[model samples]
Target: MKFVKDGASDIGMKLHPFTLRFVDDQAYLEEEYRSYYFSESISSIRITLVLAIFFYAVFAGLDVAVAKQYQTQLWLIRFAFVIPVLVLLLILSYRPWFRKNVQALVGIGMYLTGFGIILMIFYISKIGLYTYYAGLMLIFLIGYTFIRLRIVSATIAGWSIVLTYEIVALCFAHTPTIALINNNFFFVSANVIGMLICYFLDRTNRRDFFMRKLLEVERNKVKAANDVLEQKVQERTQQLLETNVELKKEIELRKQYEQERTKLEAQLMQLQKMETIGTLAGGIAHDFNNILTPILGYTEMALEEVEEDNTLRFDIEQINHAAVRAKDLVQ
Candidate 1:
């Protein structure tokens, strides 16, 4: 989900993704892209600058060595070719300011234009122009690939290929025989191969991103499901606690009932003992009453027979009184 703006002469060429822009903040997106752009630009600039300087020095030394032995036109052409590369290096060195602009296209255009000019000059002078052309295309591809501008990089690569083949046809058109292939042709061919490799790498990165996002989504789903399950477990645990409490209450109730039953059994035993004592007391009272009645009759008969003997009658009455007291005790 990105857009790529063509940095060359085509000002309107843009590559837009077929998706919604979820990033709501334009400033944030711009800043993020700018950081990446600058980082890559700085690295590329340093590398190209160092390489350009190195080549220039080497070419200058060779030119000096073969000044009298080789063509003057060749020396002058090689020397002129070095100037544009140096200018490109200078422009790329000021990458910080380039990021402050409205868009990255401005900086990209400046770089591409500088590189294009150098290659054009080299081609006209016939000084390994094919190699520089292929290198220029490679630079464009690498820049876009790192900065998330795939479409534009592809477009630049396509044009570079078309132009390279045309230049190749012209350069080797009337060659007598092939002794040693020109370094320019080899350089351009290698750059195309590198571009293909870069394309595959970009594709692999995109696939990896898709897979990672998918895994993240699945992980979130599992987390959500686990949360629900934990909630259910918590609810079931609460129910178990309530049930356990109820069971304890039931056990206490059973213990209370058992205690009441024991008390009732003791009370029943006491009642049975009382009933047996009442029956025994009634039987003893009846027997004592009969005996006392018999004693009273005998005493009365003795008193009547001994009317004259008052003392004997009194003694018999006392015996009947003592018998009555004994009857009461038995009752």
Candidate 2:
């Protein structure tokens, strides 16, 4: 349905004046209203049709009292024409096409119903049944309230009933002027009142339909916003999880690097101790070689001077051997 652009403060809706129907541009909304209105009012319409049929049949008793000579003929008109049509309309109310063109079809049913009464009045008024015109008011009431006819159908059916009554009463019946004027007053009053009720009731129904649709649109919008928010929350949660995993990997790498640095420091300290021990050992060996060199030279000079057969010569030979042994140890 199109919204009216008249700078209204609320949701905009516009309806035609005569019929109180949605504008032509709102065909889809009008169709939706037809379905909704039918569902809402169909049961009541059926009950009203049954009541109408019952009253029409019971009025056969009135035929007996009012016009005894033509009671049988009147019964024929009631049973044969009007009651059956009401029954047919009741049956068709469950059919599919009734929903599509509900107002037009209702107008037809109401026409047949009121026209049948006009025929009865046409005949009976000749015998001074001047009060019979009051029955047509019942048609307006039933069509408006019970049958739940929309303003368009009710107006057309009501005005047409009035027109038909006028033609018959004026042209053929030759009724008195006073009776015609009296009937016209009541007829016009009922139609006007019925039309007003029908028009307001329709306006209320259309307002309800628009509100329900607007509520649905609002609900869908909220759901869409919630979905987007949920998606963003999920994405941020995923990013945090990824960052946590990366930090754990970096921490593990730092631990491994600290262990490697400790191992390298221990190896360097051990290498420094080994080099200090080697330098101390080289210095001690050089000092012992210097002392041994002097002892070896003195022992050799004593061995050369000594004899082979004397005790002193034997002592000198032993000292030379000890000195030679000490020199080999130093080397």
Candidate 3:
């Protein structure tokens, strides 16, 4: 339902006169629309019932008063006709299934109520009680105020009542010429005014329905957007969580590599230290071997110079043994 751009008001937008029509492009006769109308009618049941009962009582009392002064039989007939229609309205009001046909029911009820009133008016005129003709206004008032109906239904019902009354009064009631003219004028004026009011009432209701549908559409759109946004947020959150897990694993792997590198560096340093010690020991062993070689050469020379059985030769032999032991140690 597209709203015309106009000044904003309590109803959300200005309701142009062109918008007032019996046919609504935005759902008016659809199921949801009918349901809305049905609910509204159901809600008004109590009020309509009370009004019916109150009017029935008033008219019954009037019937009694007029009957005492006029024909009792005709008043009885009017009472019987009106009382049954009111009872039917009350019964139908409480029937949950009857709401679907609410417009038809109300139209029928209104027509019957008008018919009863017309009958009473006929009797009143027959008894020369012209003053009671003013009561016809009650029918129009009741149609407008108590019963909620579509413009077409109301118009049909309203005109039917007037037409029936005119025909019955003109044909059967034998109303005088001046009185007939007056009744015609009154009924016509009342129906026209009632129809106008019914038209606007229906238009206003349709506009309100249009606004509600528009709001529902907007709300659904917003909900869909929010759902999409929430889904995206969840997906992004999941992706970030997965990325965080990967980063943690990478950090742990890097830490493991660093530990392995540190251990390797410590082992490499120990290997390097062992290599340096081996080189130093080899240099010291070469120096010691050179010293032992000199000692052994001196001892051998001493042995050659001295005799085999001499004391000096024995001392040279002990020194040669010591030199040989030192050479073995150097090797």
Candidate 4:
């Protein structure tokens, strides 16, 4: 549908006014339509031609039923001209050229088939002309609606047949004025009605094509948006994963820092306790040094008095040794 805006002008035109073609600048879109119309109508075109062949061949029996002046001209018109042309059209359906020009070829085939009926009317006697006129009406119906010719092509083919019939009736065939008027009336009516049918059919088909193109565009946009969303999700997921990993590392580092803080706090507490004990020991040692001074002086005096190889001197010397060791500890 991106093409809908730039590729077509009357993206809004529901029914193409005259040409039944897109704007002149929209050639690419027109070509796309042509391809779509061709492929879609080809099978029907072939089937319609086959039906034409069958029916046209069957109508050869009319020559036997309504012979005028022993005329075999109708038989030649059916077998030699019209049936062969319809068969050629059937064969052309399989050709590459036909894909691009299907409507034109089908229109041409339709016109020639109607013209063959006109020839029949010319060759048939006045007593049996009404039957062939009805055949012409049938051709109009098939060409306009069933053969899938657009309104323009169907109109051209249909009115051209009418014009040819008028000329043949007036100049060559000697048709009475009343009969020609009657035939013209029916022919004109059929052409007008067929035009309407072709118009509606064409309009409807084009609308459907436009809707399908829009649907494709919407689907593409949705897919693109979904792709973007998916990419964003993946990116966000990766970011969260990285953030989680960093968060885990931060948590581990914080725990280690806390543990180190606790260990330092315990070591500081132990050092403070040891320092308090040392302070207490220093005060006690200072007091004890003062108390041991007199004891050391008296023990030395007693040792001096108990000298001269006496057992009393030995005991006094031991007491002096103990008092001196105590004094050194206090110092």
Return the top candidate by TM-score.
Answer: 3
CA deviation > 4 Å runs, candidate 2? 1-10, 24-28, 241-331
lDDT of 3 by residue, 1-331 (tens): 3332234222343333443432433223355666776776666755775677577666667666765665465456455776677777778777887877777888888788777777777777777766565666787777765678777777788889888877877898888889889878988898888888877887777767767866876787799899999999999999999999999999999999999999999999999999999889889988988887878899899888888888888877888898788778767
Q: Candidate 3's error at 259, in angstroms? A: 2.5
Off by more than 4 A, model 4: 6-11, 24-28, 68-71, 126-128, 245-331
Off by over 4 Å in 3: 1-29, 69-79, 281-331
Worst 10 residues of 3 by lDDT: 1-10
In order of lDDT, best first, we have 4, 2, 3, 1
Candidates, ranked, TM-score: 3, 4, 2, 1
Models, CA RMSD each: 10.8, 6.6, 5.8, 5.3
In model 2, residue pairs whose N, Cα or C atoms come closer than 3 Å (at least 3 residues apart or on different chains), thus clashing, are none
Error of 4 at 326 (Å): 23
lDDT leader: 4
Question: What's the TM-score of each model vs. the native?
Answer: 0.47, 0.71, 0.75, 0.72
Q: Report the C-alpha displacement of residue 194, candidate 2, in angstroms.
A: 0.8
Model 1 superposed RMSD (Cα): 10.8
Off by over 4 Å in 1: 1-191, 286-331
Q: Write the per-residue lDDT of candidate 2 for residues 76-167, one digit (tens) a residue.
A: 78999999998998899889887777678778888888998888887798788876787798898888767888887888899999999999
Hey, what RMSD does candidate 2 come out at?
Answer: 6.6
TM-score, candidate 3, is 0.75
